[model samples]
Every structure is written in structure tokens, then in C-alpha cells.
Target: MKPGTSTQSALPKLVTCPTCGGDSVYAPSNPFRPFCSERCKNIDLGAWASEDFRMPTTGLPEDQKTDDEQ
Candidate 1:
């Protein structure tokens, strides 16, 4: 054990990447956080911009439904 290096009590949390389904670092040190890399992050952003991703449809009353949903 080096004097300057201290042992970590626990391992860093490895979160599942939303884009690639690979292990991703969820710590502050990871700039991409939930995503594995900039590429994966950008891919998710592109999907949002292209309207490829949509929120779950919740059944609403006929009057509450949006014009597009109707």
C-alpha cells in the first residue's frame, strides 16, 4: 500500500448504459454518467430531436385527448 494511495472501501457503481446496455460509470468522474460515452449520449439526443422517442401513452378521456392522439 502506497502512502498517498488509500484503498477504497467499496467499488464504484456500474450502471447499465441506456444506449448500449453496457456497464457505465455513474460517478462524478464519468462525464457521460448514465451513458457509456459521448457517442451513446449523442445518439440518445438525436432520437429525442428526431421524435423517435415517445412518452408512454396514458389513456385519457375523449375531451382530454390531444388532436394528434384522436
Candidate 2:
């Protein structure tokens, strides 16, 4: 153990990449974290920026709903 270094082992954990559906390393050593690489991470971010991903909601019209129903 060194002065500025902590006693923690960095092991690569398998994770599914959100953009490519592939294996990725989920560890602190990986700058992309859950994503496999810079490309996959950027792709996922692009999807968010382009509104490719959305949250599910009821199909009811906004005007048809009461204030309490919202």
C-alpha cells in the first residue's frame, strides 16, 4: 500500500452496454463506467440528446384530465 493509494482491488465486472447491448466493464478504472467504450457511451448520450428514449405515460389527453388526476 502506498501513501496516496487506497487498498481497494479494481476488478472488471461484466455489464450490458445500453447502446450496443454488449458486455462492458463496470469498474472505477473504466472511464466509460457501465458503457463498453467511448463510442457506446457517446451513442447513448446522442440518443438522449435526440430524444430517442422516452418515459412511458398514459395516452389520455392533457386537457381531459382533472387537476387531481395529474
Candidate 3:
């Protein structure tokens, strides 16, 4: 164990890819952290671009206006 050296560098952290649900290296060594491969990363990007993934909203009706508008 050398000074300023961390044990984290010795072993790669394993994580599940969001797109494929597979094991992925969550480290700088892997260009695609949290993703198994570029293919999986790209697929996630495509889903975002196509609006397949969405954030939860309050579901306010279009007819109703916000207080800011008043």
C-alpha cells in the first residue's frame, strides 16, 4: 500500500447497464461507464432522443394555467 494510492484502482466496480441490465465496469478504464458497450449506450441515447424515456410530471391539465401566468 503506497501513500495516496487507493484500493479502488485495484478492482473494477461492477455495475448493471441501464439498457441491457448486464454487468459493466464502473470505472474510467471503461469508456462507457454503467453501460456494457457502445451499442447499449447508443440505444439509451436513441430512446432519449425519441422521447421514449420521460420524467414524471404533476399531470397538470393544459387548460389550467400556472400562477406565474396570472
Candidate 4:
């Protein structure tokens, strides 16, 4: 190792938690990375389920809803 460089520097940088923006450890070695733990992971999952995330649609097929309905 170089005099100024340490083994810790070789390791990945610390990541911030997505949900709470808190300090998080790099868990790339584990399957659940980016998230600090299972709890934070679940919180993100819940947001997806609750429609906090949305995908835009140009318009429904003409057959679906009438012109009066947007």
C-alpha cells in the first residue's frame, strides 16, 4: 500500500439512505444495497405501491374513456 493511501480507501464510499437521507454503509457485497437496511427498503417499496411513483401516459385508447373524461 502507498504511504498516503489506506485499505479503507479501496473500499466503496459511504452511501446516503434514499428515504431519509441518513448516513448509510455500502452493502454492495449484499443483495440489498443502496438501502441501509430492510426497514428502509420496505419504506421505499410502500411508496411504489401507494402511487407515489407515476408513469405518464399520452392518452388511453379511444375505446377506453369518452372525450368528456380526461
- List TM-scores for all candidates, in order: 0.67, 0.65, 0.70, 0.57
Candidate 4 per-residue lDDT over residues 6-69, each given as its tens digit: 7865777678989878767775664456877788889999999999989887977777987588
Q: Which model, 1 or 2, shows the larger lDDT?
A: 1
Q: What is the C-alpha lDDT of each candidate?
A: 0.89, 0.84, 0.91, 0.79
Alpha carbon deviation, residue 69, candidate 2 (Å): 16
- Global lDDT of model 2: 0.84
What would the per-residue lDDT of candidate 1 be over residues 8-44, giving only the tens digit for each residue? 6446889999999999988888999899999999999
Q: Specify the highest-TM-score model's number.
A: 3
Clash counts per candidate, in order, are 0, 0, 0, 0
Looking at model 4, report the run of 10 residues with the lowest lDDT sum: 24-33
Ranking by lDDT: 3, 1, 2, 4
Indicate the residue-level lDDT of 49 in model 4: 94
Q: Candidate 2 at 42: error in angstroms?
A: 0.7
lDDT of 2 at 49: 97
Better of 1 and 4 by TM-score: 1
Candidate 1 pairs with clashing backbones? none
Encode model 3's per-residue lDDT on 40-60: one tens digit a residue. 999999999999999989777
lDDT of 1 at 5: 78
Return model 3's CA RMSD, one decimal.
5.0
